[model samples]
Target: MNRTWKNRGIVFTLALLFVTVEGFAQGNNNPPPKSPEVHGDQRVTFRIQAPNADSVKLSSSDIPGSMFSRHMAKNKEGVWELTSDVLAPGAYRYRFEVNGISVIDPRNTSFSESNENIWSLVTVPGNPMMDTRDVPHGAVAEVTYHSESLDRFRRMHVYTPPGYESGEGQYPVFYLLHGAYDSDDAWSTVGRAGFILDNLIAEGKAKPMIVVMPDGHTGPFGYGDELPMDEFIQDFKNDIKPYVESHYRVKANRENRAMAGLSMGGAHTLGIAIPNLDEYAYIGVFSSGVFGLVNNDGSVVEASETAYVKQNSEVLSNDDLKEGLELFWFATGKEDFLLDITRATVTMFEDYDFDVVYEETEGAHTWLVWRDYLIEFTPKLFK
Candidate 1:
């Protein structure tokens, strides 16, 4: 009798578990899709509730604007819904386009990134692409002053190399630029530039130097038809250089100073730094368009992009640059939309009897690739 009772109890427990599982499954026919959870201060999400609209498009930096077709069953109150997987954390600017007009997220109260007034801001946790491993991180200080040139308040972010104040030696400086629709924080905040430089300086790969990140999108100086080429030069000479010399203990000379940038920033650096050979000895351009091949007059000298590259192929021929300027480095991912442009720019440099360091990696136009480029490029500068 005791053995029979034990057997009955075991069977009854098993039956209860089976019923419970079946009931749970039946209750949830289609499981709810999980939203992105925070991962080590990383991950990002964008949501909009447009119940009446037929289609809504969401656009953000780096990622293309994606379209979402709303479904009544998936979204509450018959609203449109869309979500992104875990995204590398940092400040992101995005906008929603209902039909054709651009609008900020009605639900989100975050501030807009710029005055042009299209996209709003979203801050994520980790900036993995621009991660600086706590070697010797620097603080970001905003210095504001009246500018006689612009006749307005001018601000610049000055990055003092590790132990700048305690150390007696003056350091070299690199003026890093940001692309269009970006600001000075793009380097320190999102790019993790201070972290990268600190690590490089600690490892003895890069010489300790003050890095100046200036706002590159300042409109024409002194008004009256500002040329991109001329404005590019004026920014370095008038705005950026004077500020560094006055405030920081920087080596205000040509050999120790360097200039580099990406995309629009790259174009700005090349245009400004190349011809003014006396100002910057080391120069780098990452995934910049072939705007340099054109003349100062803004006219295309080379008949075709193909011919232009062929003409300047020697300077940017290989990963190991031949060296004409103190250091000429340019890199781009194979999948980058501007790969052809980088290749062409390299070719143009080579054809023009200039030597350049050219390299290609794997990725599209993104911060991930740009971050790695910093790692690789940092070691080469001031070497």
Candidate 2:
């Protein structure tokens, strides 16, 4: 912490930046490309300089593609360029893989949106984007711990309910998940989850519950299925759940437990909840795309919309599901692309003779919708 070391660190950082930029500019005729510019249409033109890299590709869960890859073409001088189509307004996490190493744009000084980890942000001009909302929010704590499964310390965020430390009885628990482009802190921070929970709890609208948000993004190939789904399941069933149960005085039962999330996390909630019918009693899906949409191969028949309807129709015709397993909830913003999928899910569940509460609001796939969904969904838990 001495002046000498601090000076050295600054010098080292500058040196690294110089080398990184120079390395890319060496053989290129063009100057380093400018930082991405977001337009009114939500299109983002991303430019990165990497002259030495043989190839570069943009990796993100927000962008739709079979490979989740957006290849950047290098100019004669080695600067790379690629532009994204009009994206939905929300927080989209991405990185530049210069050959292999994940990197943030050095030129863009937007600062890290994800705390402790560095990822850049492009704020789309709009009212409901995650970055634009103004609300009295809650604190976001990113605590790290050693995990036996990952063989290293991992991190998770715990959004303590508004009156968390103050009262008497143990509260219920809600395990929330984030979409593909988000991490544990995405909801509590960007999505205003903590603030929404705080307001609801203060108003005596929501049952007091411990909200546990964990990082759903594991990137072996950026947002690909190379991740260990079974390990994730085990971590939830064994590590996360047990850790929370032991640390916090949360009621441990299906009636007191709920699970929900946005997009990918919504799908994850369903995937985890349906199998563990005895564990989670309430389940919510907010603009869920991964599990609610088509399968990995892009086949229409494998879509959740189709599957839900088919299953529910069969169940209804046979008088199946006389005993409901869980409380099903679905919500999606009107402007969100995932609306179709959510609507289909509701119809399917209804057809199967299950009561599913559905909420369609005015917003897009951004944090605005997710936060709104949480505000409505949280009160329904443990009631």
> Which candidate leads the pack in TM-score?
1
lDDT per residue for candidate 2 within 12-115, as digits (tens), equals 35534643656645653555568677877888887777667787887663444413667888877666788888776554555676676667666565533342
Alpha carbon lDDT of each predicted model = 0.61, 0.66
Alpha-carbon deviation at 235 in model 2, angstroms: 1.3
Off by over 4 Å in 2: 1-139, 166-168, 221-228, 289-326
lDDT of model number 1: 0.61
Against the true structure, what is each candidate's TM-score? 0.67, 0.61
In model 2, residue pairs whose N, Cα or C atoms come closer than 3 Å (at least 3 residues apart or on different chains), thus clashing, are: 24-51, 28-77, 29-77
lDDT of 1 at 157: 71
lDDT of 1 by residue, 1-383 (tens): 34323543453344334323433544534332222223443545455444444555666654433323221222544333455555654445565655554555544444333312334455555543344465776555655655555656666677887677777788788888776655565766556677777777777777877888776656623334332445545756776688778878878887788888887789778667755665677888877756545555554456244433454344334433334368888999898777766776777666665667888888777665776777787777776
Q: Give the TM-score of candidate 1.
A: 0.67
